[model samples]
Target: MFTSLRLPQPVIDQPSRLVLRLGLGGGLALAAAYGLAFAVPHVSLLMALLLLSKPGPALALGKGVVLAGVLMLLIGSGVLLVPLLENYAVAALLLIGLGLFAIFFIGTRQSHPLLSLLLVSFTLIPVAGVQGQALALQVVHALAGGVILGAVSGTLMHLLLPDLRQLPKAAPHKPGVEDAVWLAVRGVLIVLPVLLLALQNPALYMAAIMKTATLGQQAGSLNARDAGRELLGSTLLGAGLALLAWLGLSLWPSLWMYTLWITLALCWLGLRLYRILPTRHPPSFWLNAMITLVIFLGPAVQDSASGKDVLTAAVIRLALFTGVALYAWAAIYVLERVRLRFHPAGPRNGVSTC
Candidate 1:
């Protein structure tokens, strides 16, 4: 009896340890993601995955990260005749067409799925002149940091969510032509918003429309009413976290503490919000405005950007950014709800084979 009991305790303890390690790893990944974005907010791998998939551990997660990183590096380096690939619109259209063909005929060869992801990433490549070696190096550095972070975070998540084997199977082992098309469509939808944003702001816009579009695709289709409920839950959680972090900053000038406090607060809010506000409703602009206020207030007070002056410049900048991001999310959420209500997508949610 003692020996049997010992086995069970060890088994239970092992997974728990793994979970802790993975979660820590994920946290580090998030930090790296944030750091990289500070330099070039476009193509943010952190926000990409966070906004899309359910957090979990999968063996392939690391591979996917490394693969994406290398691909981005290669493109940044101007390798594989990508730089010479003329006619930006023409080329993208061609690739989309080719992808469509692959979906129908080849039906997602083992290599197709990764290639599809690679193609999606290619949308970030500027159609202008070639990039210099220096630019390539910087891009590589940022991508490497993000990839490492994601690998660690994903590994940690795997530990926490140990039943990854039970992940939903792809639509069909055969070929997911419709699924791929849907993915491509999703990519277009996600990218379109950023593309428009870029037209509006040429300075800070990193031209990440494609990445955002792909992210929306990855978020999967919001078909049923439940889908709205989930986004509602997610947005509220993100909002609450953002608010708590602001509170911490207002209270003190500790960066690390603020970050940690916000992370925990977000987790708690995620659980609480999901349980309470279980329905998706259009959030009032006032609610968003309040969130925006907290974001600025926290940073300005915590950072002490204003020593001699009563008001800090950082507060102003923070307010601008917070207001924009919050409003954008709110608008997107409203649009999604509208789309769901009107056209109403069919029940086709599942992992993409291609």
Candidate 2:
């Protein structure tokens, strides 16, 4: 009976399995998010993509539940700051800065993507709350829903496209305390300015906060020499893909078409990210490009549905994202220079070992 129930295996290799998982899982997440009309639907798709990026078994049900709970708790914690932000603006900013530093420090010391999720929660939630308590609550719900959707889609994909063999995981490098501190400081500098700006007009700059969060994670992995190319290049690549997708979807203008475009793009990027498609660019480049594509495309879709000027919004968002990327590159460069000036014999290869 078990043999009769087993499906034929079309994905035999690890790379093919990974690509299929990303494509199918991302499409399912995207379809579900928009089909159900969840608030901030793009976020759910983005979470799914992030989870699929890790080529391994799906998260267990028990762990997924715990992760969802923890994520909700962390993200909801931002609501507590709404009053503090209104009453003691200066103190609130300082406290947020310190929190950012600590989060980045922990991320640098331990190489895990959970840190990115934490950074996004810590940064985006409070900014949303500044606009209104209701909006903050909505964001919390959206984030928690995204986490659950990602876990479910990822689990389904893994079962459908299981790897033939499990590969041994590599041990990640941990930066020393001093190096971690420096990297953490750099990440804080990259994110805090944007967060402050978002506080001024949370509705307008909310998307920027998300982009900045991605930049902060990207900045942590890059050295000065490679920063500009990797940062700006990936942003541009994502924008170009978004444009192409928009044009393609405009011709068709249907939900299925949108999902198809997204799935195809993810498959292309996943091939590069998993090294199935040979390229000189690092996996980070492809990862960032895929993320940027989602971020850009999601908003455009919303604008169209709401009768906003999609083209104008896309152009403005592209410009804002470019500015953020430029700032991140400059911050990384300046910080690296400062570190070298003070510590003449420090490691010059990457921001942190991992």
Candidate 3:
């Protein structure tokens, strides 16, 4: 019926080229993600989703971008309601509880729970901290960042390969309901420490992230050695990239040149590590580093008014990653021992029971 349509033959004959093009498109999209996330306030949730879902095949990538954009818009509008709702703690708790309940009732039963989880978890909450016109600014920034990341990435993917729409679905893994719950519980447990850190020292956001990871059976279940190795691999990769970026900036002051050097270097490192890693651990780590480094550098380096001190921001990010990696390694190591001592049979024994 649609015989007038002409499909390009290049896509069928050269999938590799298509993937590469899409990946580059994905990279640019990720860059947008980094920029908007830090500049925007609460919309960081969408940024998190984009980072988490980037490894998926082309179809999933498209879905993620669309989902993120929709979420960004919804969240952007939702900010208007923040003023009507008073009491930050109460609002936060209510939103989180309702979001989780919705997830269990509606999201969990679905075949693709990850998307549901991302949307629910990220957009579920209202922005907290202050109660005036500033709220609008925060909301706009947050949603703007996420929306830009999603729209840009999705559009870029479409332009680069045009085949992302046709990618195959991934095979399903066994639904670990018990494990997920346990992991969620652990996540709750870990939040205590982060709360403590916030109360005691707000500067420990990175530490809070690592310490929180330790609270759950999710991260706990990975092989102890593998987890530690992964943390090291990922962190070192970030540090190396940061160093390279610093060098590039030192040599060539142009923002465009800096972007090219940093992006290419990070991608090369990520691809190389992916190829050489004995297991999937290093690749995962490298991927994490690549995602985070963009956030770490964009404003810190780009904002000329922030004393124009690139070295300081670079150092701060490096330290943050280093400290977090150390904590992550230690936590994973300890959890492994606990698993051995208590649930000797291993994670399959359900000792890492979420």
Clashes of each: 7, 0, 3
lDDT of each: 0.41, 0.84, 0.46
lDDT per residue for candidate 2 within 162-255, as digits (tens), equals 7778877877677677878888788889999999899999988888898888888878779888889998999999999999899989999998
Top candidate (lDDT): 2
- Angstrom error of the Cα, residue 289, model 1: value is 18
Candidate 3 per-residue C-alpha lDDT over 59-81 given as tens digits, one digit per residue, 9 for 90 to 100? 34556567656655655544544
TM-score for all predictions? 0.51, 0.94, 0.64
Model 2 Cα shift for residue 290 (angstroms): 1.4
Per-residue lDDT value at 306 in model 1: 34
**Model 2, stretches more than 4 Å misplaced?**
1-11, 351-354
| Predicted structure with the largest TM-score when compared to the true one | 2
Compared with the true structure, the alpha-carbon lDDT of candidate 2 equals 0.84
- The TM-score of predicted model 2 comes to 0.94
Candidate 1 per-residue lDDT over residues 1-354, each given as its tens digit: 566564433343332333343334434444555544433322334322332123233435658566656756654543332344433645644553454344323323232433433443343333211244344344445444444545555655565545524445344443355555554444344444454454344323332333232234323433334333433343343445555556665677554654465345433333332233343432222222222333333334424543633244443444334433343345445655665676477324533323
Once fitted onto the true fold, the runs of candidate 1 whose alpha carbons sit more than 4 angstroms away are 1-23, 30-69, 74-140, 153-176, 179-183, 204-211, 224-233, 269-354
